[model samples]
Target: MRLVATPFQRRPAPAFAIAVFLAITAFANPASAATPTQTQPRASVMTVAAHSQIDTRISGLHTRLQITAAQEELWQKVAQVMRDNAGTMDSLRQARTSQANNMSAVDDLKSYGQIADAHADGIRKLTPAFQALYDSMSDVQKKNADLIFQTDHHHAAKKG
Candidate 1:
């Protein structure tokens, strides 16, 4: 038996082969290939990229919204508070990772819990600041702020 392809069919054969090759390359792999620890640096690089994207989006939103005097003042305060608390959050993450590294050797979980609890407390303390800033925003400023906040939150949520 002989199979003959018309011109139209002949044109698509190469494309079809390429598609199949791509499919095989994409899916022909072990299900559990890399462990989390092995990919931590990759994950961190992604986190940095996401943070960059969020910062760019925030800057764009701020420019588009043309924030008012009151909103600008409150946002500055919020930014300062966030800057101060960034170290606290990073330290908390490091403490958790350190605990993981020493899990079998250390019998004390209390200190780890305390570090986490303090991070939570810092966030709680910032609630008033966040609320005060949000409440003072004009309609346009609020919308822009919400968009920026939500986008950043979405990125953080995905990382978590």
Candidate 2:
């Protein structure tokens, strides 16, 4: 007998799902391999809300890390990196999805590798900005930041 892992489970996640700096990852659920359900084709109609009922704010990050005014600039850089990483991962995932039917085993793995490569690229860009922000934090703030990143309990909980 053989066990087969789902694509989402098999693919590398650190640089991909962790949302650049892991903030979005912290706030949201990781995507799954389950086919999305659609009642209509091609998203024929979409609604834009002036104010989302669901709070998508990462202001919780500022609260959690107790970011001071002095730290806001550095924090913004970290936030931007997270957004950029998410965009890159989304593009890679969409490309993989588009080609899913015709992909050979090697092609599938290579496509997954593209995501891993992008993740590594994201981290390389993320590290310096994060390090700078981390450096300027007070001891208490640093401890909180360390706790958030080290365990990433929220992401873990979702996976389980």
Candidate 3:
């Protein structure tokens, strides 16, 4: 006599009831996928806050470097480009989130690579804006602007 796997064995009434419930649920709600909007509200708020921080930092640089009206006008043009490319920033964040979840040995490495590449791509996409701003700067002010706008360490250096 052939024997089946335990999973294929005769289920008790309670087990059958659970299976039927699951089947009905699967059919009643066929779509399992969720839209990006369905993500946590706090997460969305955090993203908006992050973008606002970037805006504030840029404004701080404008003040620190004493940008001219002409430069301010030019910066507005650069700002428009940054806003247009904002989706790239979101993509980078999503890539990092994906990396955080992938736990398998090889998956971890691949996810890490993807996250890093997204960062690099984001920088590449933002290069034009940087160059535009740089070109608008005077030779003496260029170094100062870079120093003030060094976002990597800006928040850390803030004491309170």
Full-model lDDT for every candidate: 0.40, 0.53, 0.41
lDDT of 1 at 72: 83
Q: Of the candidates shown, which would achieve the greatest TM-score relative to the real structure?
A: 2
lDDT ranking, high to low: 2, 3, 1
**Lowest lDDT 10-mer window, candidate 1?**
20-29
The alpha-carbon deviation from the true structure for residue 126 of candidate 2, after best TM-score superposition, in angstroms, is: 0.7
Candidate 3: list runs displaced more than 4 Å. 1-46, 80-87, 94-102, 149-160
**Model 2 lDDT-worst window of ten:** 46-55
Sort the candidates on TM-score, descending order.
Answer: 2, 3, 1
Give every collision pair in model 3.
none
- Candidate 2 total steric clashes: 0
Give one clash count per candidate, in the order shown. Answer: 0, 0, 0
Q: Which tens-of-lDDT digit does each residue in 18-134 have in candidate 1?
A: 111100000001113234343122213323433443345445545665656757876565544443343333333344444443443222333333433444554665567668877
Q: How accurate is candidate 3 locally (lDDT)?
A: 0.41
lDDT of 3 by residue, 75-120 (tens): 7755544443333334334443443433444444443344334334
Candidate 2, residues 1-160: lDDT per residue as tens digits?
4344444444433321446344222111112332223111121121122011011324556677888899999988876665555554554544455556666666665555555555666678789988998999989889998898666655554553
